[model samples]
Target: DHFVVLFPILSRNRFSHILKGLAMSGRQITVMLSYPSDEVGNHLMDLDAMYKANLNPHTDVLSRQEFRKLFGYTFKHPFTGLDYIDLYMDLAVDNNIEVVLANDPLAALSYSKDVLVATIHDRKHLKNLLLNNGGNTIIGLDELATKQGKSGGYNPEFGLLGSNLAGNNRLKLFPRDAEQFCYAVQKKLFEKTGKTVEVLVYGDGAFKDPVGKIWELADPVVAPGFTAGLMGTPNEIKMKYIADNELVGLSQEEAQRQLKQKISQKGTNLLGQNASLGTTPRQLTDLLGTLCDLMSGSGDKGTPIIHIQGYFDNYASE
Candidate 1:
């Protein structure tokens, strides 16, 4: 029987025990580390350290192609164009490799074979799993902004600012603000067209803040407010429409009159219905840092894969 288990992190001792247990149970264990050939050597060195400490050397580390061949099929991932981890799971079943340890989330999904699948979510409370005893914290963008104050620090603006900061300070920092910008652009488009539009944001190497440049380049007559102005125009219309039709269930004319009165009394640019979506940039860098710690075996108790014994006992009993 083959099993697929997803784990956030585990201690070295615990991980060693799992490997020993799997081997003791008369199962051939294969540990697959998702890394390129150039990088696999370093990963193997870390695994070697674990093996040396535990004194269990039964597990085999297979390269991507070698592992794929065990399944007797060549399949590429539809989206990533990489070898799908599902193929390896199927291969494990066919080749009778009882336990296969991997770190890819794609491996966590359901597969065609009857292999037992289990996941351990012990690190749900953790922002990022600490590997092996490494002292590193993975924080989200809001936390990052809070830690380093700047206007719109948690938004797409941060990426632009980060580029300038890195250059000015001569610090090596890579910021991935594409995801956040995509959310903002999508939100703006949705407000304008009332339709959910998918946007693919490509990174332009010039990371100097885009806000001022956008304003300078924009047609003053058409897009006076730049990005925020463009977004606000449709937002105002949407809010007025909602106020007229839904808020008090008033007639269109009366709702417009009341909305105008409210705006005149309070202020223009009032908050809209969908203004609180709060899509900020997540802490992807933090996650990367955590992964680096885990892979280097410097993380706190950092075991990349957790082995759960008797994982299929309930299913087998039933």
Candidate 2:
């Protein structure tokens, strides 16, 4: 069995219990730490620390693989958290795993039909308008949809009046601002679960307005796949269509070469420091689903199976 641990930088006693539980389950396991080239030794030391800190530590359980190099540093993040690069390197070294998988949102963005909708609401009226229209169209309140009541229902005044009437009529006036609503829900859930939750937003254009601030509260942001006069690039509006709205295509060597050229030429890393964060649950689930599908035939022997337990100071962190 191979246990691949993903972290930015290995921290105190994170996987001590997991190793012990694997041993107790009587599986021959090779541990792989997924991290960066620079931090391999740092994480190995952390693994050593984890063993030392264990209450009933076993010496034979701790081991290290020949450190392998990374392609290059695309993500310039802090030297903490999970090391995904290490995971890939160690897997190739120890068990000779053929496939290296990644489903991180940013990585997946070019491969999935995911729409990032940043919403801004002015006063309560915007919410009412959003709710009535199923929260899709973009419009300004100052702009008239119809002219006075002179043309009856077709008039812009009638459109505004009808909108007002709908607002007063609906029994439950839920806020139409999805960003605010999602943030509120996530905040409450994180408080209840006591789990660290981070969101990374990517966009361009007038994203700096209200919705962009909301995105800032999220973990990080990658701005405009395209830009114009201000930034060299065009924006998602231009490339996303040609790219089929999926980032997987970009990961390919040919596609990456083209995209990188465009980014270097025109795009400015809009979000800046705000872009360093991990994957979201939806993204993780997507990755896991792909893994399950790929490895579904692991009946017993060909695929290594092991049961492991993990312990943390407070909530059981996975």
For 1-318, candidate 2 gives per-residue lDDT tens digits of: 332221222322222322233345443333323321112233232334334444122212222332222222332223444444444334343333322222121221222222111112221353344435444332332232344355333322212211211222221111123344445655775899985443211221112224212111110112211112112321212344324543454567767565555444533443322221221222322232233323432235443322212311111111
C-alpha root-mean-square deviation, each candidate: 22.4, 27.6
> Which stretches in model 1 have alpha-carbon errors above 4 Å?
1-66, 69-73, 77-101, 104-241, 244-249, 260-318
Each candidate's TM vs. the true structure?
A: 0.23, 0.17
lDDT of 1 by residue, 1-318 (tens): 333333211222212223333334444334433321111111222334444445232344444454444433343332234433443334342354333334442332322111111112122232233222231332221222223355333322221112222232232222345456657877997999897654332211111124312111000011111122213121122343446445686776877676665434443434533421232322332222233333433246543432223321221132
Evaluate model 2: give its lDDT.
0.29
Whole-model lDDT, model 1 = 0.32
